[model samples]
Target: MRHALILLSISATSLFLMSATPLQSQTEDAQSIRMNQVGYFPNGPKRAIFSSIHKSDTQKHFRLIDATGKKEVFRGILTKPEYWKSADEWAAIADFSQFTQAGLYVIEVQGGVLSAPFQIHNHIYEYALNASVRTFYYQRASISLDANHAGPFSRKAGHLNKSIPYHKDLGKAQNARTASPGGWYDAGDFGKYIVNAGVTTSLLLMTHERFGSIFPDGSLNLPESGNGTSDLLDEIRYELEWFKTMQDADGGVFFKVTPLKFAGKVMPADDPSLQHMIGKSTSSTLNFAAVMAYAARLYGDVDQSFAQQCLQQAEAAWQWALKNTSIRYTQGTKSSNYKDVQTGGYGDQHFEDEFLWAKTALFLATKDSKYSISIDDLPEKYSAPTWAQVSALALYSIILNEESFAKKVSEKAKVMVQQASVKILKEVMAHPYRINQMNYIWGSNIVPLNAILTLSFANHIEAHPVYLTTSVELMDYTFGKNPTGYSFVTGFGTKSPLHPHHRIMMADGIEPPIPGFLVGGPNRGRQDANSLKRYGGYPSQAPAKSYRDHTASYASNEVAINWNASLVIALSFLEHQRALSIHEPK
Candidate 1:
């Protein structure tokens, strides 16, 4: 454990840089300190990075000051100023990992420089997991969010969808309607897309599966609090039950349920618009199949009938996908005469990933050799999972289980994960902030969470102290230890997003954005500048610094179900790890 801690510290000499497109900057504005604003576990690794544009402003020492006590608790000499000038002007670590007192404190340098205050309690991350999980309940459609459940964010039920009509593109009359009701609003808007739901539900289910002990019955205080199931599963079942409605008679799944255009800042209850059953695609069917098959395995003992139904539906969807092998979702625009907008689409021409995922899940659920794919077909590159690509998720499931596949296939899966970890570890060491992904894209925050989720899975495949510490360090980057210095999630941390690009929070008259939501962080793409009229510009063009906490900055600020699912998984996994190791020293 001590060796793992040493390797993770910023004191490590060798550093690497992946392919990154840095936004060239010469303006003098880089004097800041960064650390996890949400706080840290008492026994876990603690680190802070300080940056300055004044290449000459060399402060040799740093101090840890208690915010409440207003006294120096510890002090240490800063590392030699190195040229980490790509993202940071000057950088060094204030690693007070040994000062394990439970209190509120900040890292200080040069007498006045201080980082955001953070707590040092054992249960520092408890509310993060609970609040993130509860946000799903808040995202539920058709159910009124009463004061008892939603607190100040309460609202009248909206998008009940008692009659959802098929869109003109669905080979039906424009007026046909179906009673497909009640799931999550997929992202910032009210529409719920099956493709998005598939990944979101899968990750949430995986979280509950591995960390089931953390979320007990009635833990979340949902309406289904005492219903003999964990509140986490109860919330997930709401999505699963809705998944039952999206399936066609022939076992196919609809791509999405959304309006043609977006509603302009209208509250859910007041937004009078129609949602249509959008086109169906191969990707959606396969995603549904994979999630359902995976879920069936987990829920068998708790809900036998539902589990059986899920497995049957999963097989049927897989068959439908096989028959209609090439359909893609080139459907309606989220553009707004009709209203409620959903999230993005799956890949237009790639169903290979989908096939691999669906096949793997079915193989696991049924233990049937026929559902297995060949080891030769395994993806050469294991990228971080997105809605469009989930082969990595399939590989993770395979690697997590002991001898779940043919020897060659299982060995290949483990190698792929292990290879990815080595690459990720290099990125973690090379980046000044110790982040894995340096080139920011849309929903950039999801990359690290997914990567850490991958690392957590890697640890299960082959136990390594480095994997655990890598997960913890990258998790630190998520909470606020990076260049952005924002917790990236709403309602946690000393500094967090106040205005995310979410319609509910925008129209609900709430002063703060919805709690537990993780915004699309620091997208250098700046797609919002073109999409919104008179857009609020991004703070910087740098890949890691190009974020704005404005409701109009959808490129960087929109909250999504998939992103929330990843955050919940990463945070809860660490929380589970903390519980395991805290007792070792106590």
Candidate 2:
């Protein structure tokens, strides 16, 4: 008994000593700064490179070096370091706007660290825009790619569900063929979802509406390029055609067409699985109506016949929504299980938002006072709109068309804009990240990007410099001002994710992930066990620190179509605004 007590005492003392030992030194890593690898200057807005340096190392200076010869192009001291309490470090800013001479340059920091090589030229972002927009082409389903069209990323066709037969319940035989094929895959998967497509298509259409004159006919290099219409509209029309196929004879829109189960990690051409054109709900029908109406007006001058078809379909869907208003997506036992637990369900319990969205689009398409009556009671503030919650779309349409409406409607629209702008500005000032979210959930990167969009809208209405400045600050956070210090984009920055959760890039044995794809940033949901397994026992619980670069970390690193749509819109706006600024007299 005495020997046992002596052993226990010794073990306790050893445990105490182990607990008292200090952790390893928390030195700042060299890969902590991120900036656009392909930069711009002279005719563009000022570029700011970001770093998270230790508080003790705040006085360090950085130099821009000529990449070809290792000669120093310029040296500049970093701006006063700002401490981020969430990250427990000081954020550093390095501005290279003064280096306007055309050259290939790399930013060099202390201890011989270097950023990715970048160029100072007028057309730098033009290349980025092309790459970003063409990424959608690579994600096209029911289509074949050749070397001429997709370059080295060519592959065979996938999911040619052209002969999609109606379900037996629709009074048509399930085995009979009905033509329905062609749309961009929703994400890393080869699925086509209506709710996700609605938001993505809206953003793309808005892009064309704003920059139609700027982009040339063949800029995107699609198969339909130089076809007497802008390539941007051509790309959108491809998806819009597929969207038409999703609507039933009853004018109801199906939620999605997906495999019965999630596919393995394989190329789109390799995934030879049966596709199920699944269930429809009120939200999906209303979303379909909203997108169709908006597209009808945009395509009016370009293709009159197609525009008229879109308007007819939009009216039909709106009528269907009016009759069956309260239906939500429930996994009915009838037919095959399209419950969609595997992919995104896109279920929205709030039917009012979709109703309002469809109403606004219909109002814009036709000068109908009936749609205007529904706009009296608007939401107090806008919460960075998404597929699930899209009231902001209605708000935007109303604000844009205020002048065209009578006093009763226009006055309400103006008041909603002012209230929303004040709310957004207040939130932007309060947050340390300079964005408006309280927590970082799944697809958190979209939060800041959406805020940038709202700010741009407000700036358009009032033309305040503060709105633009705040927008740029949010852009800085996205590029790399916060924790993780990694660019959210796959290939634009000094340090970016090489192993994105993209199946094509993974199966192709590529050296780097596809360019211009924006990975979902820092999702603290941490729900996937696959992600947790690859966390190396160091998963961060904090909202800003929850991101990892591993391919298995899909929660933090998966790229999605809707997220990229937001990015394309934001970046295109910047490029367009900058182009105008360049020609302005000083």
Candidate 3:
């Protein structure tokens, strides 16, 4: 039955691919061609091509043509379709065996009934296959989709040689020469990718027994250390050094700061987003710091002084948060604390970022009697029962004073985990895309998944089968199997729809343009202009755009920093788990 469903899906995808129209052609017949290859260069002309449906009996042919019909770039024998799937959708493969560079392309069947043009931006492929390969072990490890078609961890217990190459390639491509000193291009507001890269690397490093490595100088590729016991002391050491380079003097890592602008304004020092650090009650920071600390311990031989310094910095940050309690958000003056300020100010208030994660970090860092008291006496200001906050609190309780806090947190974690399990399972059963804010299944969904892992580790609750099932499912959707790469865009207003394309026809009024180099966008051409009309008008009332644009400035940094921090932590957790599994008693 499963095989039949898969076959059916493939057929439907093929039909869909063959039926859509290409962007350049207006007539149905001309448009029916599917794009075989598409490529985009940073500052070069877009390129595209179409596959010929009717192959000559004597000749297998491939053709590349420009929009003007004046140029036929190159052609070769058509190759087999490259099959790949995203979270919810199956894509029919068009062969791109002939082309090498990036640009737009198209493919068509004989009837002219099926055609589509895709904008091929190889940056994603390059990042995943090139840059990541250099630094980490990728070839040995393979992400697995479990029975439920969800991802829990990379599968295959093997030597390092196989896995490290794949990851190193991906890292290298992702960090391919761009405008940032960090090597990787920042995803701007979607800076989670940066965290993802770091986390992925750390995990690979932690499990070095399963993934081999090539030294930075590329002098030699080493074999697996044999067994999982070859202490990842060196890998941990490197990670610590890498992390230090990521930090700022004030002890905060700006989510991303590059593409240097004239004002030298990247991420400002006082952005509320920086508050997501754990010592500051931001769940995101806490989670990352906790993972880092955990990694430090597991790897051992880490620079203890450096580790202590980081811990101290974290402590100071938390102290600052506690001391600066008066800087709460003013939602018409009803706010009591920063939590209230965040919930009232942000839409989808339930979505967890760094703030909620920090609570757990604080508890872990201090373990002091007063901190425990604060945890118990957490005021109504932090009363919101969002899953993120609940998860962080649950983890914090278990980590700080496990015996005392476990009973309550365990009960709560169980309830929340059950709820999320039901919600996610039902959605996946119905169809992956059936869930609202489909994107959330990838980005926001990670929070609940991490919470489940934390809760399980804390013994707050028995291992909930559903929690694992759902988490695996979400992971599979985003990073397992044939993962779909998300193209992120910046410059949207705070009120802008989460999906970039959705905001194209803004009904809201125009707002002041965001200050800086607007990265990728739907209206990539019009980002520099001051007025909405120049950018094909606002999605809503012109005034609403202005209002949203202006208001966006206040929360942008917080959103970026918090999300990035959270991602790093989540990745760290995964890496830690992998490391532990290496030495787990069989």
Q: Can you give the TM-score per candidate against the true fold? A: 0.90, 0.84, 0.38
Q: Model 3, poorest ten-residue lDDT window?
A: 158-167
Badly placed stretches (over 4 Å) of model 2 are: 1-28, 40-88, 94-121, 164-178, 332-341, 411-438, 529-541, 582-586
| Model 1 Cα lDDT, one tens digit per residue, 1-586 | 2212322221121111001112111122222677876777776677788776345655568888776667899998766555553353567777777787887776677655655566787776676777788889889998898766666678998888898888766676556789788899988888888888888998888888788888888777788877889888899999998898999889999987777666668888888778778778898899999999988999998999999999999999999998999987763354221123343545458988889989988989998878976877689888777888888878878876747677888888888888888889888877766778566889888888888888887887877777877787787877788777788878766567998888999898979666688988987777777655466466566677878888888888999899999999998888888766642121
Q: Considering only N, C-alpha and C atoms within 3 Å, which residue pairs clash in candidate 1? A: 16-430, 261-335, 261-336, 262-335, 262-336
Better of 2 and 3 by lDDT: 2
List model 2 lDDT by residue over 349-378, tens digit each.
Answer: 887778888888887898777766444556
Query: How many pairs collide in each candidate, listed in order?
Result: 5, 0, 99
Global fold similarity of model 1 (TM-score): 0.90
| Residue lDDT tens for model 3, 508-556 | 1223221111112112122323544443442322210111122222211
Can you rank all candidates by TM-score, best first? 1, 2, 3
Full-model lDDT, candidate 1? 0.77
Cα shift from native, residue 212, model 3 (Å)? 13
Give the candidate order by descending lDDT: 1, 2, 3
